[model samples]
Target chain A: MAGTDHDKPLITGGPAIILVEPQLGENIGMVARAMANFGLSELRLINPRDGWPSEKARAAASKADHVIDGAVVFDTLEEAVADLNFIYATTARERDGFKPVRGPEEASRRLRTRNDAGERTGILFGRERFGLSNEEVAMADEIVTFPVNPAFASLNIAQAVLLMSYEWMKSGFGAEQTPFAGPDVMPASKEHLNGMIGHLESALDARGYFRPAAKKPKMLDNLRAVLTRPAFTLEEIKLLRGIISSLDYFSPKTPRGSGNPERKAKVDRDRHGKSGETVKDEER
Target chain B: MAGTDHDKPLITGGPAIILVEPQLGENIGMVARAMANFGLSELRLINPRDGWPSEKARAAASKADHVIDGAVVFDTLEEAVADLNFIYATTARERDGFKPVRGPEEASRRLRTRNDAGERTGILFGRERFGLSNEEVAMADEIVTFPVNPAFASLNIAQAVLLMSYEWMKSGFGAEQTPFAGPDVMPASKEHLNGMIGHLESALDARGYFRPAAKKPKMLDNLRAVLTRPAFTLEEIKLLRGIISSLDYFSPKTPRGSGNPERKAKVDRDRHGKSGETVKDEER
Candidate 1:
């Protein structure tokens, strides 16, 4: 009864973690700890490196043995995720698919809501050695990745699950208030983005991006998907469009291409006047 | 005369940044700033926010004024890229194309080789407002992307430029080298990787990972990529894989989905196990 919709906890309430082909008992243990840290207790392991009830994992779990004991092990991602209504695949590499990929925070946010809805949701984490395969990613409705230092993007197994869980919990547990102040308050609503899209379409059409008549609709959808993925709130959108309109008025491109050539070739070097580093060097 | 490579004594001489239809002057300025910080100065704007030579952009460029002022505007990416022999396009969304895609570091690595050959190369970043159109991405040889937070995949134009520039500079300069020891030796070689991979693969084979027959190749590739991406030195990789193997032998995933569900969860609170914060009750 406690696991029922309204009675369930916010962040950990919905999704289960399905680790496919994990190779290390320690990583399993660490992952369990991370999961517990993020409030998620339901775990499913498919082909773990060490067998379950691992002493090594038990030794490493810290306070998360509860999560480990509760974790389920399976043989494949498909069977692991079959029980869930919404499935998210976690990966470190780009996969071939049409799935909407989001970072950990976004994934958590979406998953948190599903929990509130009482939907059985799960996140599939691939093996510690590799990650989820393309086929595996295709099975999920979404893909979750993390923004890490590009110079060093090899996040540990436990780190990945932990970071995602952190964000999901923070975003979904009525923790919208932040420690650091962001630019604005509200997330861009769908209607607000639609207005922005209309403006952008007009601008594109004027520039002939709609080119052939038959391609217009498809182009619009593509443009919309790319531009409006995470909608920008009204202020941000308005400010951006304002900047675009101003630039168009001043240095607009041609009908088929962007505006003037002379203006385009200039390195906008006027920022620091003639004093910036070597201004003349930039002036070809 | 200006288009000549000699015209600009490029800070670190990596790749030029060409931004198309970037909607925010602040963002363009920021991109310039991002480039400048990483010793990248060539900034090309196809179309920008707030007009060329925008004072607002200059002011916002922070320390990137040198990059902002030297920025070149282009009517199209083609015109902007005319001087470069190789090109890479950056997009947040997946482009429907067959072009080989590379992460930012790899993109820079290729460009560094071309640069060493004295071949002019440039990296193109799409507008923050709409990103590069699929057509634009198609015109390029490779797609450059960041391993970013999936939920907040959008990088400010400058942020994206900075990320690529950082990778390009890091590689071109060969920063320290992987397993970078201050006064000690650099990392191991490709030969070392082969041996290590062979060893690990054999170890994994012994564990029954080659199961299902169809999954072997993908699993191997996935493991190889994860281990090699950060290019771990002999010690690092050895330490990592060693830990993994040790854990595997201890406890593996339960053979079936649920292995004795009634079993009591074990507890281990090792100090090495970093269970820093509790994720459960932070409802705020």
Candidate 2:
């Protein structure tokens, strides 16, 4: 976990997010949460309906207080875009006039290029109901519309923010930053897993866990499924083998009841604790 | 918007999401919202703390009611995942047992391949406080963990679902389904964009909007920046050319004050309505 902390971000500066007359405090807070998830920091509000610093907004922001706390409030859209070198307005409705509309991906790429050239960029999210006015859309450098379900193209403000934020982060930082286990720990080979499976099967068979002969193959497959699915490391294989050895050591040497049915049942109970069949078999 | 409807989807089939012992209704609703955004439909709840049919969960889901409506509830994790052919358990903590671990990307790829081959797949999200247990993880085919800020690796359940759901959609759909304009509507070439920029800059220049002469170059660059940033279609370029022609048509042949200043301000107000300065300047 030491080196892993390198990727975790308290906040990142990329593009400003300007919400134009957002309606709900909860949505505002949720937008902040989504931004934090993808390493975006700047949040600017253009005349929020509920006004600034709503307790509801702060509460809904979850752990993304950094974003909410640092939010910038603007009196109007013009003031919002005044400082930004580039601006994109998000709207679902089509404008009557000529506007170059792009999906989130293309918009994100454009943002990356402008940011790389040391320019401030921002995206505008319109009011919840009507979206950006035609005049507001005209003021922006570009329009970004989602390829969403037509019957249900209406996206929650937070959802829209999340999609764009995700695209921006993925484009900039490459989404495949997941950490991999080092070479010091090797994955157990198929041969080793098979050996353990065979050992466990033999022990179970000795105790008649497979039952009435006809179900043996299916039962064997289920056992194999349980064993094969896990990606066992060398240490894990050794640990499982040790568990199997312990079970094998306590196996009945002679007849089922003659030696000790009690110990056999105990091992069965341990192996198939959830099945509830071991307890029933003991009573029978 | 007619041809645009072709890409819209009401729902899409993908991997299921199984929540094991999830505590809050709000979290469940949020999970549904995230799932719906990525087109994942199946949802199975395992022993929710507040039980089933939680109104709080429904309210929190926002417009993702379809997901909540179709959610299947079960008594235990085993029952929840009984129908899934492939399962990945998500957790942050390191496991002591033998289990194959994969990043969300790899895990999503596996899900896509399995799904394409006509097999059911699902991902397990454990409780919020302590993630999936070693025993629970052992039941999975692979372990999936986000490369989070190790210091704050505790992603809320909804956030975790959003990440995995996003990866699943990206893996299967190629992340570039942005609707490019059809052959009838080609993308405007760089030459065309440059022409439009030059036309707009000249128009603004003639109107004395560049101001005081010293800021001419920066204003020209800003005009070009606004004109060139958007991905314009052929129709959009032609329409913008028409707009420029209209502006040129109404250009004052004589001095600024000699022409009707009132009419000039109206056009400027229509063009840069949000700026407020246009209206203010006319008043002065």
Candidate 3:
């Protein structure tokens, strides 16, 4: 699912999703999940091939039981869309006659507008194998077709539903309102990040990890890039620093090994007058 | 899938999708299908639970055989995302530390900008049961989490990937750029529409459908609304006109034979001022 349940009710009067003769239970469950991801609750099935109340669908739906529980089953497309003031039929192939077609994004906006204006709206999806018949499509006010690969325009039932549901959610929330993560954790300051990087650098240096000092700068930059990329928190930095400390202590050769003459001479050669002996013992 | 195979090269250097410890082949296949929907090709797997080259995954992928065929498997998350310049880990729960969390939309834009600048990028999704570990997420440049329900923040692996892939495709091609339909069919002209409406209206009038004269205008308006809503093609208009003609000819009380002459005369009186008694016979 795209969004959490409590992420502010972004959608108001969102369109109902009607699946016509959907075959597989997995697809139905996935459709329910996709709907819930986008804050869509209404699920209308027009004579689902596998029948209603399927265990496979429930299991596949994962946690979107709300959508499946409230799902309305209809005998025909006409019955399915009887209450909707506006309807959009999804189809991959162009039908026999001219119908105004809309892509998912545009259709989503229209749904929002019409829904906001107090008109009931719903999107109709066809069967998995054959799609909506011409007569079934005739009942729809607009045709919605994905700008898909012409060579392979077949979209499974759930994928089509997912695209539409995603667009609907995006239209309601405008992407900005969708949070990346909750504010329970705060980002570690730059100084803390720098300190952790220094800790790792020294640990690696002690192990002769930065050999061939000529290419050390680029290697250091790469390491820094990798370390700083995740934007570690204070706690993560502390954990990483602990890991660095463990590595330094567990290594076959430590800086303290230089207390012996022969090892100290080898360490001096490895250091090579670069950043060899700059180990800062700082605690965070 | 959102797009067909020949939707032109709309995306260049799209990001790789890495799944870590995926449990089911069905999930991997769905991820491939979702990726193919948005024109993504590169797929990297990190120690899948069901193993590689899964027959179930291939079956689930449907037409995304290309993505499945090219999937790369890695033993660890470190190796999977190593070659990529940037990586975002998808996780539902708040991990140990703070990281820059981005929604799919923003992340997708960054990915496009980086890819356009010749930087390789990829996204990491954790396992089904438990998401990426702290150590695994620590390797990512950023964290990406769906704005899912707090009570049940579980989005199946494929749905998460689908949202990200959809955002990626949408960022590359603005919603406006997505076509509604191909340009082969044109909306029927007003004259053709009017002709079809008139045909249906006269057929209904002959059947005494508008017997309540006061409501005729509203009924006619509603009829026109239904007719025009679909933006019918010329051929559709012709087909509809044919249907009207068939109904008129097959009506039990066609103008040619009045079941009750008095009632028929009254119907004639109601339809008197309007399209009185004209019918055109044509063959396509």
Task: List clash counts for every candidate, in order.
Answer: 27, 1, 12
List fnat, each candidate: 0.00, 0.08, 0.21
State model 1's lDDT: 0.56
* Best of the candidates, lDDT: 3
lDDT values for all models: 0.56, 0.66, 0.67
lDDT of 2: 0.66
Cα lDDT tens digits for candidate 2, A1-284: 11224355564788998899999999899888778766788999998999999888998776677889999999988898898899998887777767689888779989999999999999998887777788898888889877554533436778778778877866675654554442234657877677666656655555555556687787577556545543555455554454344324333545322344565566554453332211111100
Worst 10 residues of 2 chain A by lDDT: A275-284
- lDDT tens digits by residue: candidate 3, B183-273: 4556778877876677556545554455366777876776576456546666555544433443232223333223445644543343322
- For model 1, what TM-score is found for chain B? 0.57
Stretches of model 3 off by over 4 angstroms after superposition: A1-13, A151-154, A174-284, B1-13, B94-98, B149-152, B174-284
lDDT of 1 by residue, B164-251 (tens): 7656655654321221112222455766566556545543443344445577787566656534543445444343333322222222
Q: Which candidate is the best by TM-score?
A: 3
Worst 10 residues of 3 chain A by lDDT: A275-284
Which digits, one per residue and each the tens of the lDDT, describe model 2 over residues B1-284? 11124356666688989998899999999888778766787889988999899999999776778899999998866567655656787877665433456777667786777677666678999887776765566556567876654423336788788778777766666663333332222334444444555555444544544445776654444333223323344345554544343333233444222344454454454443221211111100
Q: Provide C-alpha RMSD values for all models, in order.
A: 31.9, 31.7, 33.2
Using DockQ, rank the candidates from best to worst: 3, 2, 1
DockQ of all predictions against the true structure, Cα-based: 0.01, 0.04, 0.08
Worst 10 residues of 2 chain B by lDDT: B275-284
